[model samples]
Target: MIKGAITGLGKMGISHAAILGAHPEVEMVAVCDASSLVLNAFNKFSSVKTYTDFEKMVESEKPEFVVIATPTKYHYPMVKYALERGVHVFCEKPFTLTASQGEELTELANQKGLVNQVGFHNHFIGTFRELKRLLSQNVLGEVFHFSGESYGPVVTKEKGGTWRSNPEEGGGCLYDYASHVINLIQEIIGRPEKIDGALLKSFYSKGVEDAVYSLLRLDNGLSGTLLVNWSDETYRKMSTSLTVQGKNGKIICDATEVKIYLKKAVPSEKLEKGWTIKYITDLALPVGFYLRGEEYSAQIDYFVDCISNGRKSEYNTFEQAAYTDKVIEMIVNHSKTN
Candidate 1:
């Protein structure tokens, strides 16, 4: 079994710990957080050694792997500490606040020959895997345009002051939420060549962008757009839809479902049709289709498998994380200017 420790017992940390504990191939060895209240809450249910200092936990438990679910600002230092100890790492998304930090960490992990995985749970979903297979098979031929949106309300303290509301803490809808969309886009279409973005701070704390929209041009000549907001009154919604046009057919994958429209001619008897719109039912995602927890569990399983079997993990690598950071930097810079 792969012995593991988790730091930062906030929502994400607790979730990772639970998933790891449930996995048959993993043994949860320790849990840590700077907050005594959080540590005490976790200790009530878990017998794992709890500590306020992450390095102390690592020194005592000597777990083979560590999960860094701390806030964005602390990610760099914590990950560096773990890597220097020769421990494998599984870090949350937006791995570091900047591209440079991500690149350095990636280099360090490579030099140490350590297994490093970043949490981008959507990549592990069955729906996304199917989409990848279809793309590989040219089902989404000559992909022309793609768009994604992830919008929800601010998850901050009721008193309105929280780390999530501070730009220095890497807080913003674009960085906190859109990282998932950006990561998924990287998976589907590779990195963008140039990006232009606009950010808006409406209905949230001052100086923090609660909404963002970006346009990206890919090297493949394809264009993409992303809309992420924390002020959307609509129910929590995350959707990524791509439209691809080819000589043979057009393919569309919206949310969790897929559709292919062939361009073959119809019978002469039915040739009187003029641009008939067929609502493709196969492209509709079923209710309660995408389960977030299932994706999280799959990611944990893949991380454990990579550590135990010496297999390559499809989880986000350090290079990918760095690229993501660069994209984020561009977005933030553009937001400030325009």
Candidate 2:
């Protein structure tokens, strides 16, 4: 069985650890956290070895791979360490502080032939998955543009001191919230050929942007806009919406379903084409324990399958993330110039 370890014990860390511990074909071997309380609590529930230092944990456990849910600042060092040690790695995003680090990690992982994946779990979501399929089927005839947003209240007027509030650590809403939609945009239409415009602003906190707005032009002549807000009090939970306009009809995808609107009447096995909605039950992969989605579990399962088969994931790889990070670098650099 492949041996797995986890670094970090925060909410996301716990989620990764849970998946590792429960994965049918893998052995959860070790865990690491700087907090004594965190380690002590995890120790009580798990038989896996726990360590305060990641290097010590790696050396002692010699795991086949590790799932890193540490804060963004520690992402590079931990990933670098694991990759150099010939261990496969699945890391959370934003991949690193800058695109250069992403490039470095991408090169290293590719050279090592290690299965590397980034945690852009949204790609595994059913509605988006369906949206991709429909787009590929040319259901829209000729696509024109795509726009989207992801918003919630994780950071507001009352919340600012955490690591998420720090630009270098987590990069505010653009990195935390906008990254999801940006990655989805790449998946659906491919990366933007050119970024037309951008607006990054901090409405609630001085250190980080609570809102991000950008206009992009895709290679296929599609122009799009994005607005991601993390300080919005209106949302009960994070809501994501993507609308695509085409020559014949339109496609709209949300968290639960994908809706299609055709200008002319057309009939398919399941869809009447003029207007039809498809929910996620049959489209998404099944899960034993779902927290917001089966995407997390699906992502873990995909990684394990890749490890077991000695192949690479077609989605959410370090190379894909590095490409996205290059776009991020361009945006940030352009923001500075303008």
Candidate 3:
């Protein structure tokens, strides 16, 4: 079995623990967190060793791979430490605070030939995956425009301060929410070459933005608008969707379904000339374990499989995530200038 450890016992961290624990080829060895209350429960209920210090847990357990689910502020140092020790890593999203930090870690991981993956779980979602496939086949030929959007109740009302309210600590809707959509756009469509305009608006938070609006141009010259708002009370939870229009047709995709409108029928794909819908049930692949979503478990399984097979994954690599970081930087800079 591949020995693994985890740092941070927050929502994402605990979720990772449950999924990795249930993985047939993975053995949970240790966990590190700053919460004594959480650690005390683990001590009583689980056999895995626990520690408050991440480096200490890594040194003592010597796990082959470690899941870094801590906040974005801790990512650079933690990922650097793990890669230096020749251990594989699976880290949560918004890879790093700056593009430079992400670039450094990407280079280090590549030099060490270690398996590394970021938690951009949307890529594992069935609907989005189908969207990527159809685009690859040029089903929507000569794309002209696109839009990526996400809305959630992360900060609906003004509240007391927390890590999320601090920009230095990777707080803000841009990092926490928009990063997901930006990564999706960069991967599914093309890398954005410039930020035409941007606006970071603050609604409830005093120090950070609750919404983001931007116009971006891709390397392929495809222009698009990004609209994200975390303070929208209408959304019980986060919802992200994408729409692309091309000469041949258009595609609208979200977590649950993908709707296509083709100007002409393609017998090869069995798609009709009009609207056709594909649900997640038909596209999602079965996994050994299920958690918040199959995408979560699917991402973990993909990382573990890459390590065991001595190969690198093309999806959600540190390099791809760094490009996402660069785009975020562009938006921030552009917003300030505007």
TM-score of each: 0.86, 0.96, 0.99
Cα-lDDT of candidate 2: 0.86
**For model 1, the run of ten residues with the poorest summed lDDT:** 269-278
Q: Looking at model 2, which ten-residue stretch has the lowest summed lDDT?
A: 264-273
In model 1, which regions exceed 4 Å deviation? 155-159, 237-255, 262-292
lDDT of 2 by residue, 1-338 (tens): 99999998888888988877778888999999989998998789769889999988989999999999888999999999999999999999889888889989999999999999999998888888888888888878788878888989877675558788888787688888888888889877768767788889888787888888999887677899988898887998788888998887999998788889988655553556488888887788886656657999989989999999998779899988877777776666667788
Candidate 3 regions with alpha-carbon error over 4 angstroms: none
- lDDT for 305 in candidate 3 is 97
> Mind giving the per-residue lDDT tens digits that candidate 3 earns over 30-118?
99999999999999999999999999988999999999999899999999999999999999988999999999999999999999999
Q: Per-residue error at 66 for model 2, in Å?
A: 0.4
Ranking by TM-score: 3, 2, 1
Clashes of 3: 0
lDDT of 3 at 34: 93
Candidate 1 lDDT, 100-173, residue by residue in tens:
99999999999998889898777765555555665676643466677766766554323366777788888877
Q: Pairs clashing in candidate 2?
A: none
RMSD of model 2 against the true structure? 1.5
